[model samples]
Target: MMDGASQFATTMLLRPWWLLALLALALLSYLALRRVRGLGAWEQAFDPALLAAMERFGHVVPGAARRIFWPVAVAAIAILALSGPARRIADPDTFRNLDGIVLAIDLSRSIAEGGSLDDAQAAAQMILQLSAGRPVAMIVYAGEAYVASAFTLDALALSPVLAVLDGEIVPNAGSRSDRALDLAATLFSEAGILSGDVVLVTDGDHLTPQAFDAAAQLAAANIRVNGFLVEPTARHGDMPAPDRDGLERLTRLGDGSLGNAADPAPLADTIGKRAASALAKGETAALFFRDYGRYLLVLALFPALALFRRAT
Candidate 1:
């Protein structure tokens, strides 16, 4: 508890000079000892704890908790002191093309096919490379949209999530294009948000008018909804499919004749291409926002911090 007070004091001062608390306390101890020697009558008046406590007062009162408060005051202040945010030093240079992005992938039945999954994964890889390790959010859409992952730059962690894209995960007995499109908008307005592009991955077959309307809504919110169609091909009997028709042309739909992912190589190549193009854009990336609670991290520690607290 007293450690917290010391930390708070340091934070309030925000000055390195306050670190001399120990030296100042030592000098005070010398002066006090001199007085004690002068009054040689009452030698037993000072106990060890009392003397030590007095010394601590000299240091802790002014230095230990000069400005800090709150239970996590030490942790919070340390975080602020060590690597201060956006601090401009003498020769400051910032990296180029850094931004947040959200990748809204279609997990409809059509993506279960060979080519669809490949294109989607490739797109993610390319985006990761372009973002220079910026946080990316992941959303999977089918008859509905589910957030598979949250915003992060951990590329390796995202690989397994990208691997599990099938009709099995989301039972798309009938494609709900409207629902999927709405998910796009909902995804953007979520936690750990950053300004970036939104990449929609799906076969052109699912393209419906309603989904286009939803995309337009997202675009209006500075979230660019770019379409990536996994076109149907006759290779190994794989066909092309896209979620929505044109944003304007609802009734008149065009044939989505694209690549055939007979083998995994072609599928991988396609996904890579789309992802590369989208990710290369400096302000574009993949955002994977998740709904994980703080308990997960706290549980790793003595989560009892929340379970029990001071009566006051």
Candidate 2:
């Protein structure tokens, strides 16, 4: 139910039609004054010589000036106060990114050797820093997949989860880029984001038929996959060599570029650009209204107070 005060406020008008009330009063007052003057009684009651003497000394009463100014001024103030005034407040939805980011890290036995996972982690941290607090999700996958954290803007909160990730976190053995990418895609789908990028941090040592199919699916879904191929200088001759050609193809198919872990600047720049574009597109076209009518009412008080002052 609407309160009495709210109902009354809405009914009031700054430019009220009842302002004609003042006009009617002024007309009536003018007619009455004219009739009184026509009767020649009020003027007769005052001596013509006394009125002329008063005018000569500049001590004439300012009744005519007061009538001409105060009523109109007070009415204008009251009318304006009745007109509602408002301020603008920014809407939260307008500033939020419509898309989301999913970081898919390859946490296989291969990344466990020669500090490859460490380098990937460092690169991932840089990517997060560059994001400027866009919503981000994390996926660590070997033969099996595990979600370290869901999409969120709070990097500090996600840090603890990211820190605890290791090759052993996924019980299964071997690198499965296909499973990781698919899971990242699933995360984006579940979150209801139609378009976003998935960053793959790996050595690119293996690529099953499933990986190629997953990349195609991701591309069709408008999900770009970026790759960071981390190949450390210290050679472990026993370990299998990374497939550079396969990594390049993965990036090409994913509609993104493959960057070397040693120089992540180019990849970071690209990711940063995409994030900026998303943010710009997310802003609301319309502004929100905030009521400032009460403050306007305070303004009416000044003119209202002037009503009591003698008109100049």
Candidate 3:
């Protein structure tokens, strides 16, 4: 909720250039006023002294000079209305519930070796099911990144694709979570999403500085990067352990949380809460000010009516 002063602070003119018409109107009004004072063509035909005598004697009615003011008033109001004054207002229908989510799944060889691919897939599925109709996107990354799905309201559209996502599907070898984050940011940019979430479902393998940097960038853009650590049920002695510390740091830098894949409901709920908070903060891509310029036209009606009545 904004105070009156705060709302006034945000007030702006959408068509500020139209305010220049006020200057033109001022010039035209000055010329019209001069013409009214001079009694039109009579001033050109007769001497100034004779015209003064006619006005003094009440022979040439100069009452029309007052009428000139009516038109000037109307034009001034119309110009103001055209300038398009607006102020920020909470519009629930348009701005609320506009936040989106992008799920970035890791398809690295380590996940297959650790045998946590099913857990990763299940975590992704639970998030999609709990997304509450928000437009969701997906990115699958190994050494490289690829968009599995663009933004869509239908969560079912992504289920089939998520079902087939495996470590071998991506031709690349190593895990590059940074590429996943970068690709998620690109998806948000293409879809004009200003604020959203990026949920990373991975075994937290091959974490690097670049991955943290990518998460920082997403945080800067008002997009949180959460992690769903898919711990392996059958751990291999040769395989690297899940980097919980690194994932925690990544989420911290990205201003999000780290949730275990064993229970994905909490992460899904967190995403929902963050989205609701964003809506409360008016941080959606559709956030816009309500233009009050049209209402100003209603004020012009008063002067317009005055001019009309005078003409009759």
Candidate 4:
């Protein structure tokens, strides 16, 4: 019960200035009602008994006085509607573009020295291009993770950064995609994005149990982690083969798909479709209060119809 009261107390008026009109309305209603009840200037000029007699004899219609109440009631309802009372509500449609894309590029030795760095960069760039107009973030990780670029709508701003990314840029020396996944989740939280996609571009050479755990956590948080496998060139035979099985399993746990680096169209399409699906299901962060004044205005129709009927 206390919680309910606390929630109700949070309701606010959007147009509080409209409330000042209520004082004027109250005064006018008082005067109008007094006049209807035969308590106006006429009451001062004539005896109370005389007015009572006039009302009794039908010289003054008591029913007409009662009719004034309807209009006053209508005006009060209209004034309240104009005040714009509202409270915060979980309205996913309130932020249609809250669904975003986070590109987590693996900058480990396997990707940088395995002859697949170009493929990783290309895959990142392709996803960014296809995800135009959407809020996109970038995470570059090897032994650790770093947000190369925060959420932004301009793909061009991130394209150049992706072009220059390599395993050497990150001082870390191991592969930890798990850290990347965790960092992506943090990014979404900081940006107030409730649901989004995480595109992991990697050679898939370092898959760990921790990575799978991170993917499951992301899925729980409504963030899908898709895989972009960057196959190494045939000449680089010493590099470990891409961990296709592990990548596929990670994607499955994250409720996402695994795509080949050679063609990013399907991966981009999947991201787009999933984001749209989340939005269609009203899965988004609530960023603002939903105004309920318009709904209150609907109640005014009752008194309005009464006034209309009386006038006719």
Best model per lDDT: 3
Rank order (by lDDT, best first): 3, 4, 2, 1
List candidate 4 stretches off by more than 4 Å: 1-97, 235-238, 273-277, 283-312
lDDT of 1 by residue, 191-284 (tens): 4243345555555555666766665665555455554555433234444434344422321221111232223244234333332223323333
Off by over 4 Å in 2: 1-97, 276-312
Residue 62 of model 4: what lDDT? 44
**Model 3: residues with Cα > 4 Å off, grouped in runs:** 1-98, 276-312
List the candidates' TM-scores in order.
Answer: 0.44, 0.58, 0.62, 0.61
Question: Pairs clashing in candidate 2?
Answer: 14-79, 14-83
In candidate 1, which residue ranges exceed 4 Å CA deviation?
Answer: 1-98, 192-194, 234-312
Candidate 2 residue-wise lDDT, 1-312, digit = tens: 567665444342323464556666677667755554442454577788887687689875433434445455555545554453433344333333555678888787767665666778777877787765568898888887789888887755766766777767889988889988889988988887756788888888778888878888898887788899988545576766777789889989889788877677789677756742343233322223344556766776776776677645
What would the TM-score be for candidate 2 when compared with the true structure?
0.58
Residue pair clashes in candidate 3 = none
Point out the higher-scoring one by lDDT: 2 or 4.
4
Instruction: lDDT for model 1, please.
Output: 0.48
What TM-score does prediction 4 earn? 0.61
lDDT of 3 at 238: 71
Model 1 CA RMSD to the hidden true structure, in angstroms:
17.9
Estimate, for each residue in 1-312, the C-alpha lDDT of model 3 and write its tens digit: 468778788677767899899999889988888877666777689888988888799888754678787688888878888887877565433432356889988888778667788889889998888777678898998899899889988876899998888768889888899889988988888888767899999888888889999999999988899999988877867777889999999999999999998888888787765543345434332256667878888887887787557344
